[model samples]
Target: MAGRFTGKRALVTGGGRGIGRAIVERLAAEDAAVVVADVDLAHARSAAEALRDKGFTVEARTLDVGDPASFASFDERLDVLVANAGIQTFAPASELTVADWDRVLDVNARGTLLTLQLAARCLREGGAAVTVASIQALLPNALSANYAASKAAVLSLTKSFAAELAPRGIRVNAVAPGRIDTALSDFGSEQVGRITGQDAAEALQRRLSTNPLGRIGRPDEVAAAVAFLASDDASYITGECVNVCGGDVMA
Candidate 1:
């Protein structure tokens, strides 16, 4: 059987843990040679080792998404790109320090641009790219202004790249995930609890209920969507942001 990505090569940022790791695993299982990039080189190597032990072709490398130099280095050995590296802090806009806001924007938005630029330079004419955004792109909250702004920029960036790369036969798209079980979300939920004095689980449950599906989504669910976007299955798709938000965003 010819796997969907049998001959593809993929570069996934933040591939050491959480949703990013799942995306890397899913792509490798579909027969793509994966490059797992993370800020934590140890975790990146461990994840790559685990995949390789399973007989997958994978390599680990250091990637600081907020740094363009990192992308320049990694682009030397890649094709497709998945910009899944991100961070968040919970606070009202008034309380969001300049440093925190800068960190989020630099990683989520600027980092995305750096990755896309590398993909445009390195990927073959028909190659694909996927940016991992968030439902926060559409559904803004008072506690996550910086995160939401960055995600909204991600969606815009995806469209801009799609337009710019369409002429070159390279496709660009994004997956906007809702609340999935991830360590990053766990940290954000804790911050939310501290700010609101509400139980983290209760806050999460209430948020999950807002989804028409009435539950939190899984990392694998988001990974599946990313795999599809990065595969030939979505060859004709570009300038689009797919919402895997469990019907939370109808548009």
Candidate 2:
């Protein structure tokens, strides 16, 4: 594993925390020169610093995934790109505001579009791209209208990019995680509890129940899937979405 990415240069958006940070750690651990990008420059710098301290080749940068200009500023060169930057909000369909929908889509959907566009141009032949979608992309809940739709768009984009980039030997794939143990997931769980009149504990269990494993997923678990997809081991894999949700949304 250490030499799998020995000379590779990888870029991960939203690599500041949660699942994104896990991805950064995984890639760096495998000996890649990883760049951690986030809108929150401080968090990005902190994550990169910690990894650097671990003797991994890591750097930090600022990125607003929703901004085309931000994407334009990134140098068009890299071996791997993980489109993991996204925001989630919870609200019933009836109460969903245009602002909320736009914000979510702008980051989750439009951002991914921009990310893939960057990858298409930046990634050399044999490069790989992995997007962080969500299980909600396939299974929508009462409060996931906006968030789910955004992730769904990501899945579609993953396939489209895969198809278009195949001739160049670039692979594109996605991971749909369910009830992952991250701050964003916790926020969604709490919001669900408030909407369903369940207490925090009950709501958490409710979320867990959807997964056959009866447990929340770990960031590292999702990261592992992403790493595999982005590695040469999956050279023949493209236009595919891997659900890392412990049997949730089996389709």
Candidate 3:
């Protein structure tokens, strides 16, 4: 567990599972004392327990990313922050509801805004921040209108934070994952099946086929990228995004 982050402290929103959990594991493995912050306190505690058993420095905390007040209670100085909490829904544009749009934007956009803003304040000099975006933000896809818009907003906000924090020596970047293997992928299968009138397996096949690698990406793969961007290895990087979609952006 001795790595670049041996003495660093990190916070990861939605760190209880999926890509967020992967990021937390990666940081902790690199010796960062990580706070697993999730709306589900149980999940957070579970993640912390697993990592703690492995002798990594980890802690559990409850954080509702959609609530601005949630960030206020977090006053710990940090070296890294991964704003990875988000939700997704699938519906045809014509069928998309206002409530759905608001919920999506509120969590994916406003939540990110608050989380990263806190990071900009809490991160020490030379600290780094990473945001979890989606390939849908850059690609024109069906059944994800609200998700795409919210992630696109994340892209813009990332740049804004990067610019504003540069003078203070803090870096801000984003990762846009495509067809990652996570709980969210199950939702993809169901939604794609509904849209294409295909069986679950067939829909999943189509989704995989969209990647030039002809497979789904892994959470650890995205976590590796985040680790790099949030370390001194990428000290010159900021306001940038690395796509972890197995070349799905090309497909």
Candidate 4:
């Protein structure tokens, strides 16, 4: 289990916090030299410094996944890529503006495309890519039209990339997370408050009741799945999305 990625180089977008940070830590734990790429340089630096303190080979960089210029400067060769940078906005369909829709798609869908394209250029043969999608992609939720649509597009891209990259000895996969207790999930509580007229805590409680596990998932849980897909252990898997949704998405 240790040193599964000894001497490997990995890049994780949005690695400053939450699920992305968790993925970075997991990869570093396995001995990969990890790049904590995020839009916020400070967060990325903080995460990298903390990991470095723990004796992990980690670095930080500012990367805007939606911008080609940012990706162009990413010159380091890579063995693993985790396309985890994304944003979520919640609003009723009628209340959603064009800007809201565009922003969500730009970051979640277009960003995934750009990240995968860069990985194609940098990843060595037999490398792997894992995308962070959402359970909402498969099980749509109220007031999350834009977020859900963008994630669904990511799922599609995962399959497409997997097929095209197979010839290059690269494997592409996705992890669809359930309700995870992160800042992103905290936003869900606000969304629930807006829709149901309840406080944030109550909204979260009501939401948690719907899951079969009767609780939200952890960021590290999703990271574990991504690490597996990125490792040689999942060599036979590609063009598939593994659900980490606590039985919320059975399909």
Clashing pairs in model 1, backbone N/Cα/C closer than 3 A:
none
TM-score of each: 0.96, 0.97, 0.97, 0.97
Q: Point to the candidate with the largest lDDT.
A: 4
Give the Cα-based TM-score of candidate 2 against the true structure: 0.97
Candidate 3 C-alpha error for residue 102, in Å? 0.5
Q: What would the TM-score be for candidate 3 when compared with the true structure?
A: 0.97
- Candidate 3: worst 10 consecutive residues by lDDT? 202-211
Candidate 3 deviant stretches above 4 angstroms: none
> Scored by CA lDDT, what does every candidate get?
0.89, 0.92, 0.92, 0.93
* Candidates ranked by lDDT: 4, 3, 2, 1
Off by over 4 Å in 4: none
List the lowest-lDDT window of 10 residues for candidate 4.
Answer: 135-144
Minimal lDDT window, size 10, model 1: 70-79
Q: Once superposed on the true structure, which residue ranges of model 2 sit more than 4 Å away at CA?
A: none
Clashing pairs in 4: none
Clashes of 3: 0
